[model samples]
Target: MAYNPSPKSKAILDQAWDWIQSVEYQVTVRWVFYRLLQDGIYSEKKGYRHLLSLTSKARKGFYADWRPWTLADDTRAPVLVQRQGFYGLHLRGHGFQDEDDWLARIKEEINCPLDRWASQPIYSEIWFEAAAMQGQFLHYANENMPLLAFRGDISIPEKWRSAERLAERYQDLGAPIHIYYFGDYDPKGLLIPASAWRDILAWTIVILNSKGLTKLEALESLNFHR
Candidate 1:
């Protein structure tokens, strides 16, 4: 059955919808609730719950002209596709005249690639404790370096995945991996990088054992900095 919001609820939904549309980056429902709270629209826990309920209803097509894509939860998104824009159009003032022209240009661009970090001594990545701040970091981060948001203490699976990537890259490129972590100065923040590094090293050791590298040797190339 379709949900029908009350007149008051509809007004709130309208505001939330407008706010969501105004932002360029995708936002989680929790983030949206907090943002609304900061605007003095919501005060207590009950209000937060109400916003969640209304967001669910709006995304489910309970309201007219509201689509599911309007509110995206990146954490639960099954498949993510990168939207690659053509900046060349801005410079040339005319995009490809036809489909064939576009394809030809794409093929040429793919074949002739510019290696930005080829001469760099080390591979670097920036990690954030708050996932929502990723968009801010992405705005300034270099295209070559990855920006990861741990959301808190990094998970075991994520640590293992990072370890695998680091190990593989270290072995292939013979270069070091430097991680620059950003977080608060609280107790958890102070210890999270160390804890995450330890786990990653443990996983790396296991993975690199087959290559006849010891724990100390593997640790040499994986540098973690705050």
Candidate 2:
């Protein structure tokens, strides 16, 4: 029989799920690990330690395998799709707000001495903005890449229509397209994008971070054209 998560493990996983749903912090595997550690859900010597070890063991196979998660599946196959705006808000040490003050602060901060590094290769190419006039930070590429936004309950037909339009536009341009997403880290948040865009395996999909090379390696191992 396959091993199931022990009660303790399940508790830790539950807390991790709660944290992601809260969207109080930027979601990443590392953050998820850290949050679990903080909530006393896992200990440094036992549970958290073991989980980290498992991550290392699973990393190679996880990246190599593109198995979709099913409700009836025995194991959880969570995809970590890193989004852009999440990092921006985290960097600014705040969450979304609907005020010109926030944008002004961002502009000022970006131009500040401490933030001179923002103009470097990393930040220069990324566009940061507040959407819907709300404080919800939106991170996107400066390259005019196509994008489609959908909530969880949205119909597949609408999703496909957006994807078809995006694909056609990119094909017309003859330029490689990349799909970038930034959202809370959770089963639903990660799986949604993976499931929606799994067919676009030929295109590059990158997570934004210093660990980008690791993601690249994972994609390459999966035989993605990136």
Candidate models: Cα lDDT each: 0.73, 0.40
Lowest lDDT 10-residue stretch of candidate 1 = 86-95
Steric clash count of candidate 1:
0
lDDT of 2 by residue, 27-60 (tens): 4445666777787666673564565443332321
RMSD of each: 12.9, 16.9
In model 1, what is the error at residue 139, expressed in angstroms? 2.2
lDDT of 1 by residue, 122-222 (tens): 88889888889898898888877788888876544466578787778777777787889899888888888877776676667667877888778877877
Cα TM-score of candidate 2: 0.28
Residue 31 displacement in candidate 1 (angstroms): 26
Instruction: Report the poorest 10 consecutive residues by lDDT, candidate 2.
Output: 65-74
Give TM per candidate.
0.52, 0.28
